[model samples]
Target chain A: MDDLDLDHESVYDGLLGGDSSQWAFGTDFEDPLAGVDTMIPAGVDGAALAAYCLMLGDDALIYAHRLSEWTSNAPDLEDDIALANIALDLLGQARLLLARAAAADASVVPQMPEGSPVPPEDALAFFRDEHAFRNMGYVEALNGDFAVTIVRLLLFSSHRLALLQRLATSVDPVLSAIAAKGVKEVTYHRDYAGRWFVTLAGGTEESRRRLVAGLRTVWPTYAELSRSTQVETLASEQRFGVDPAVLTEEVDAVVDHVLAMAALERPDLPPSGTGPMGRIGRHTEEMGHLLAEMQVVARAHPLGKW
Target chain B: MTTLAAGRTRAREIAGTVVDPEMPMLTLVDLGVLRDVTESEVGVSVTITPTYSGCPAMATMRDDLVHALSDAGYAEVEVKVSLSPAWSSDWITAEGRRKLRAHGLSAPGPSPTGPVQLSLAPVRRAIDCPRCGSADVRLTSEFGPTACKALYQCNDCLEPFEHVKEI
Candidate 1:
């Protein structure tokens, strides 16, 4: 039979045309909320809205970078692709949210050299210093192992999915649209992480031990995620955003169910209030390292275009 | 008739025939991503939506739209990606579903109209095998090679196939 008549043609065949080489990594980047009306609500403070978007956007950006670190390092090819896809999803969300933040308050996006063609979202992502980032402590924490990464993803995606579900109804149409699209992606992220949590927990003794240890290591950071800052609380009050604190119960329920299914005990660890609040542009030392690597190229060549 | 009005109709007809690069069997209209097509004195403008936030196919679709329109004598063509009233699996046309099944990929089931259940477990749903018309299929993986599909194995046919996931 001819190649055209093959029953199981490669999926890559569809991806082959139209300069496929340029399609790698960052080529497909586009403003997800491009055509949507991004008008800020009448009563909402622009700076406050920008700050809130930065908080969420920075979390996704930093976490996506960390996940991308697993590029060719995942245990299996499938997992490598899975983690990369998840990272891309978060990265896409980050691009839209950061662009929204920049649109709200130009000050949040760092200034570049004269005639810099870098987009605001790229500026916010690649130019911001560690202290300027507003991501939660858990996502910035170094990836310990596969189990640790999966546990962090489970908690983070769970909390995010719940929060996005409510944010989908925000008074700000742009935020609401971003959240509406985000809920579907985060749902998958949460489910993927939860399934891995159960599988690792119920696998061999070594895997179970690692999963428990990973959970214990990551549990203390959960408190920081649910902690609503002044801006977040104010935004939620004005119906511009969802309060992260309100999502605690829904997030906990999902985590609890997954842990139960895995036959694992919930770790009763104290909150790690080590660094300044992540909501207010303070992060762990590891975050600085992560940023250094992530921003090196952009900082070196401010006007360079990919 | 005004040139703009005539051009708009022609633009829509041209765009309607542009196939999804990934699912070559389905047109953008069949996949419900092509939201609107309009024409003006300057050029034609087309709006499309992504199947998922990170669907890589959007870039190809945009390029395809531009190429197809430009080749059709439209000097300037703009492809706008929208996310507001987000795309849903329910928007997949009935003809699109039939084409998908014919290609040996199970079509997406009816989307749940109510709020999605926030749970850890995979939401259980019955998926019939596209090859054998059997409901005895089990999901082997939540993800497939593409963002919008899942891997499933049919017990009756003993064949593994991809199923468009209902998002």
Candidate 2:
């Protein structure tokens, strides 16, 4: 009953504690690795594997957040549901990836009570500092128009589809398993966004202009595909990851084909936050703000079960 | 009584009775989401696969499986998820298709195989309406309420129906 404790920022300090979801069993649900093998493939450095997983997880996490924003805001109900469904698919991928990371390197997970219902996936998602996130510039960017979402999603999924396809044969059983499922999901995602990209480009002149502008804004994310980070290189060397170099040709073919069909010109622009920028703990101001909103409730009640 | 015993084993029968949370008309077994049920020395374990990666229903299915088995005189019940060989729409049982049609939702056709090739147009499929059996159904959206379905409007019946889209 700390009435007039106006300086306190913790929401859970109040009489009601917090929402039902903050309780462990509500949305936090069960373990992502319920029955899967948690063993790290031999010879693979656990920490390195964890970092790789975080990169993939963070990309999905941030992009899903951006896509979820379109829920009530899309032009049509079907498009709204379509975007939301795609976001849900990415969110599921993030959950499994984050859980895999926590399983590989326990040191990275935030400490929690024994037998706590709050899953490790939630812990990594909620407790990590903004600088700890490893998502790319494309995923962390603020939403533009609906066309921008389509452009960005198309590029991300095109590259991701290629990468995941390669990862399906990984030596790590868990990563391979996750990738096998992910390939199927991202295929639909790439197709959805690719179709939308074509539609918008061929639609009204205004929509065409918006899509071009959207492409320019998210071009940095696609450009980053040309550079391979150290972890990615190492992981690829170990047979559990794909080098960014290899994805370039296939991704280019897919994107170029889509753009050609739409009669849209490729934006000639410099890549922002190039090389190891986002994945190496460096990010734009957008990421900090996004993490702030996404983690606010969970961070406020770190021990709040749900 | 003796004749009925020729059906599926008790554990599987009970587990299969659990319905899908998103589509209640179809049981887990009918949808082919239920992969396996095996009895070991430890207990009876059930295996299920997700129709979509981000499917929220997977958790419910696992919980339902555990509850169904636990109530069926098995002390220990475990549910496992397998992601390999990814679940396909073609896996839907024949009975599952019958149940779906009976419930007015069009069942999925064959799933696309081979490497994914980008298609610019919205997905085109040869779907017949479950209600009126009309072949002239237009796709309203490639995605529906859940990840596994698509929204369609039958030209003949003029009623909106959901089709479990082929993966």
Candidate 3:
């Protein structure tokens, strides 16, 4: 029999060529933005641009961490694999954005010890305190039931899809390239969550009730996602960033259509304060727990090799 | 031909023939991922792009290129990854499309020229079954067993196959 004739049990087995030792989730890393001209655009504030990228990067990093929590806990096998793939995509985006932020301004990267081998992205992800993260509350909030996860994914993906589309045209080449690739990935993410959202909402009595309850649980934090911060405002004015506020109309239109199709109502909920606290290193109580779990391994073994 | 030019051409041919470990149906050249190969005073430099950002096949591809070039008697081989002007599904060569279908995976349809429309459902493209060449097929899942393909079942043939996803 030929070497390729070996019966493979899964796609990964085939993809890895029957040897899993060389394959790793994040270990075999290559610079995603390599060979791209990362020069900051003329007339843009380097510090503000880096800060803006931190916000975007932190959002993806935290949400990816939350999604990874579903690895062995997803409702089914397919959902398990799907959520893992989605998390990896977000992780890839976070890496690129964080790397870009460091390139734009090294000051934003957390201080690493001399001769430490940790990359800038890893440093930011593992070294930062809870109060240093800029992710919106929606991502850092504790995951509830399956319905709540679906609701959160739907809302986050929709908003992110709109924002990435606009950022695809940024004057900065690195940001534009990242957004160009992100647009496709986020489109799939939004569609995946939307499909699940409709399925549960239209499935049965229990599912419908859970879906409604999930919507109510997450609705209060929705306003925080679109609130623009001073750094974002400055970057947007300079065309280096897309203001989150500008994405509201597009986000609402997509969400409204989906809700109407699913026969679900837009939960009437009060906004959770109109502050840019999240962007300025203030986060929910859950953020501390999330960071503690995420940073434990790295903190215990600084410069550890996987 | 000069010795340098001949070495460069030979290196390109060796690198271009390295098969993608994941797909196995297409080589680097067929997929348009091998962007360019150049000869410098130091050695041969090969450039490639990834089909997806998180694609695990890139590391294998790079290693394969370096090994193949070294086996061809080229020294100081360098492989570089490029992301600007990111890869598109449209870059898959016509020959690559035929090979994918022969391997029981439907080739990706032409990518939409306009911007992607944000909708509730995934934008479904009409894909013929690779097994029966039947147009009667339905997407079973947006994601297939791998990141680059989607699962589809052919109603006419009653067989399930993978379709290379349009990015």
Candidate 4:
């Protein structure tokens, strides 16, 4: 890992890899596939659609909740708002993605014998039973040293941002729209973590050491994100989703750069097997505790509107 | 004036005074979140956009909007939140941005695009030192005292300042 110095120049230096190119910020453009009116295509697999969405949405929601925990506990008062803003962005993405998943699933599931309105809350609530959340294992791991947290964030956000960038062109309008806005948020998030990675990796020997240990702790769980599930096939059929396998190279390149920049070595640990089932709801013990805290009040007062 | 028109005129007067919970100096109307005011048979309905999704203070703002309308003699009122087009710093009025600057904070710049070089643009491009009119400033951190602002230090005035992070 390359040691980054905060003393010689501003931290923003080289954040974009010294690229002189300007990056557009918002996802407010007109849709490329706009005007083609078409019915749902043949053999359209709705279950796969719901599963993929659950994977994306659950990741956003759980991670947003985790990030929110850092509020007021950040190293500086400013970071409180920064982290909170990032969390809010993630929450917004989760709401839209989850809503999209629910809407897509609703289309396929056999409705009640008679027509009945299925409220949004119920749609969101009924999807999971603990063995199917395919979020990157990085976010759910117990909060580790700050250096480690930044590394994990850097890894996750870059991957997510890249994923969203590809999804923005999806045949599904809803998915495309959500991905469009999401790309910007994820970009900011990735940069924030990357700048910090450079700072810590280059700051001091102690910061450097902690970053390495943090990388090892978080790296094992990342394999789960790279695996291709059946959902990817359904998404590809729909024409907007990227093959998760294709993204491995991009993810690896960035991760290697950051790890190298941080003056840390990627651990050569053999992969401990874990994949798609986690996103389907088989979360580790940490998730149960997190959900207990997150869902407690809402569950206790079911149907209670604030 | 007609009775319906008269009621609307008064309701607008009351809503005009509600301040933003985040940026205290600016009114909600100044931030452009408060949208339409519709008078139904039951009561008056006020629509607004949230600055960020899941903002806890929105409930408080809604309550405040209702109370203020009631205090002004409009008994029935409804507050609606919309997320379409989302929220933009561009929605913030010029006067609100001025007030933010007066309060020692820089207004947000436009959101960046595709790939950005922060060094090329310079840290204080969108910011002007409210205390001193100098343009030479450097951002020390993206996180500021508030979520909206980034921490900046002025080169000329030698003062640490906050620049609003453009969403």
Candidate 5:
């Protein structure tokens, strides 16, 4: 408020306005596609495309949050940065994909109070109810341990990388554009987790045991990731998305190869459930808790801008 | 130059002067994030691309550009982000590479093209120590202090440095 405060705000104060770039309590949300043409192609199914985007976006957002839980909990500093970096990459993907979904169907965005600084993408992320979230349960399950997280990341990123590689050729420009960017990022994520998979498996006796257990812990929900929900099928039929079912072969080859390197057998655990779980809003009770931590600040400060 | 031509030049000059908040050694022009700047009816429009899908530096980049241009006397300014040609470490200008090395940061190598091979083995990057110029630099971690960088330690010089990762 005073001249001294203005002058002492570091080098930024010398500019036209002092340091508006600073973040408040959380990331400052803006339109991820602010400058790009966001028009949905006429031939594309708006509803299906929106649902598909939300599906992928929700998965990334939730998975990123779970990864963040390992921020200070990783076994080492290097692992900590690696996990958080991967989380940041996915969060970026989520922002753009959610923005794409809102562009396709404004109705998908949840309502917020007046004067809320939250954008469409942020609103979709924070305001939606748990059942309304379209993320698969594979990512929503609580983290078991460092090994469990690495296993989850390996599975999710492998599956997502395959999906994005095909989605890059989608008829929809935005979807294709998003997919192209995501492919490069998820490549690093998959590679990181895959290496860890092999390392942990081949490590000390206790590490090998934990690694095998981690695989078993997540195998029950493996079926959910490969099962194509109705929206995915619709989007694929409309040329706006890729169905998860088609990615099964590609993802399996990668996972199998990694497991072979680790000298570990594939867990023969049965599928947790038969068909379309999370995509239809069916999720574990813990998703509510994840959303509570993620959304509480936004909901509490709908009108608070810093 | 004509009035409009002069204005265009002036607008671009102001934009070119702004540096990245995180990596201040390189101007936005040096960094490929600044896509283009053009004069428009209302004012001038600037377009940029994000280095990564979830780069936190984007907000600062936009805010800095707006402040710099406004201070330079642009009446109206608009900043836009494009995602079509996703940013690559290869986009860093030649001068930007020099700046990065001069500041003890390893510049990224040529980006990978075509299908990205999935190797469980660590990525083998043939990099030299920025400080010692020794080819014996080894990778410490694939991820680093920021999302855009990776940690490396030079075996010959015994110094740790960050490499601007190739996305």
Candidate 6:
């Protein structure tokens, strides 16, 4: 009936573990994705691709984290599992991207000599400074209404699917393979979110208003996604990346179609010029808070295995 | 090859009953994430690719697999996680689909073939009504309660249903 009752009830139901005496959550020390191999594309600038993939990866990672926060808080039990599974799909993509970026040729490390060695997970978890991160602002923003979260997924997945579809044809085999796998999942995410937008917008008066408000909140951040950049140029030249500018037509078509179907008024938000420049070393305060929670358990007992 | 041969046979049997922690009606083997199982000199190793990176149940699934193996007296088990070859719902077996339908959920449709051709994207394929085996159905919502399914309403059966997407 109360807050603790709802929060702890699931844990107490022996769902997670038997007793409170040794109730340990998450990982103790062993890396779940350890022993996995990552294959960076050959002939491409690993640094540029790593940075670009990190941007996409971080977007999925942060948003997936946010979505998981909705567990048990959703409107129904089935919905809770649904959101959690969607979060998992994104999380899976993020993991692969991060792994690929981190495993780039030692050459991607600016200071590393040709023969120098780097542990993959260390390269992934510890090496990248804040200035090196490339995730767009759309993902790290605080949670809005459920409708808004669905809308955000819809928009982001649309863009990602476009990018992944192009990547599927990359000169690089590994990138092509990863893209092949990713495109399928993003398609589902986009379609699922689109369905929600239609229902909420067409369902009822209150639902329609909330759905519109959710769109406005996420629209401002959407601009940065389409902004042009040299990183995109590097990937495009290598024939291993999708150009942000090229994605515009695709992005616009989908967004316009979804909005009209929902019968929602589009926000006249100005396109953001702030661009990928800020994501390099700068970020919203939210990133720091998120990293703190995520890093704490891992850092606390480094190497302790469950 | 011998250990792998033996391990595969055992794994096929064990995984058949290892139901998805979330869906419960489907097994990880049916989902196709359980790639291989090998009996190493140290122990038996089970290789699995996660359907989602942050899937909370992954830890539970790992523990459950170990428990199931150990209970069967295959001690010294090691679970290896693989990510490169990502999971797709297309990997789900036909039997899995039937199980899902019997459990009152629609099965995944076939994967889209040929180029994506966005304008010609597949829509509203034949979905057997999970409740009454009716063929008449209409999609109520693309987004279902979960990420894997779409909400549909069966016209003949007059029941709303969840249809899994074939990724």
**Candidate 3 share of real interface contacts:** 0.35
- Measured against the true structure, the TM-scores of the candidates, in listed sequence, are 0.88, 0.91, 0.89, 0.72, 0.94, 0.71
Model 2 Cα shift for residue A3 (angstroms): 22
Q: For candidate 1, give the DockQ.
A: 0.40
Q: Lowest-lDDT window of 10 residues in candidate 4 chain A?
A: A24-33
> Model 2: residues >4 Å from true position, as ranges?
A1-28, A113-116, B1-8
Local accuracy of candidate 1 as per-residue lDDT tens digits, A143-239 = 8899999999999998898889899998888888889988888887888898889889988999999999999999988888888888888999889
Error of 2 at A18 (Å): 20
Q: State which docking tier applies to candidate 3.
A: acceptable
> For model 4, what is the C-alpha lDDT against the true structure?
0.66
lDDT of 6 at A94: 77
Tell me the DockQ of each model, to 2 decimals.
0.40, 0.46, 0.39, 0.10, 0.63, 0.36
DockQ-better candidate, 1 vs 6: 1
RMSD of 5: 3.6
Candidate 6, residue A21: the lDDT equals 22
Among these predictions, the greatest TM-score belongs to 5
Candidate 6: the clashing residue pairs are: A82-B146, A92-B53, A131-A280, A131-A281
Model 4 agreement with the true structure over A1-306: per-residue lDDT tens digits: 137462312233346442211222111111111222223334555566666776787788888888889887888766667787788778767766666565556552223323223344233533333454556555677767677778778878878877887888777656666676676567667878887777777878898788777777777777766777667766877674666777888888877777676566778876656565564456678877777777676556443322
Please give me the total number of clashing residue pairs in predicted model 6: 4
Query: Of the candidates shown, which would achieve the greatest lDDT relative to the real structure?
Result: 5
Best by DockQ: 5
Provide the lDDT at A238 for model 5. 84
Q: Report residue B6 deviation for candidate 5 (angstroms).
A: 3.3
**Model 6 lDDT tens row, A1-306:** 346453344444355453322233333223444556455556788788777767677777777777888888987665677677778777767766676676664444334334323334334443444555567766777777787887787788788888888888877665676677777777766776777788788878998888888888888778777775787788888887777778988887888888887776669896554766545657778877766665565455433233
Better of 1 and 4 by TM-score: 1
Instruction: Name the runs in model 4 displaced over 4 angstroms.
Output: A1-49, A103-129, A132-134, A240-242, A263-267, A303-306, B1-19, B27-50, B57-86, B115-126, B134-140, B144-146, B153-161
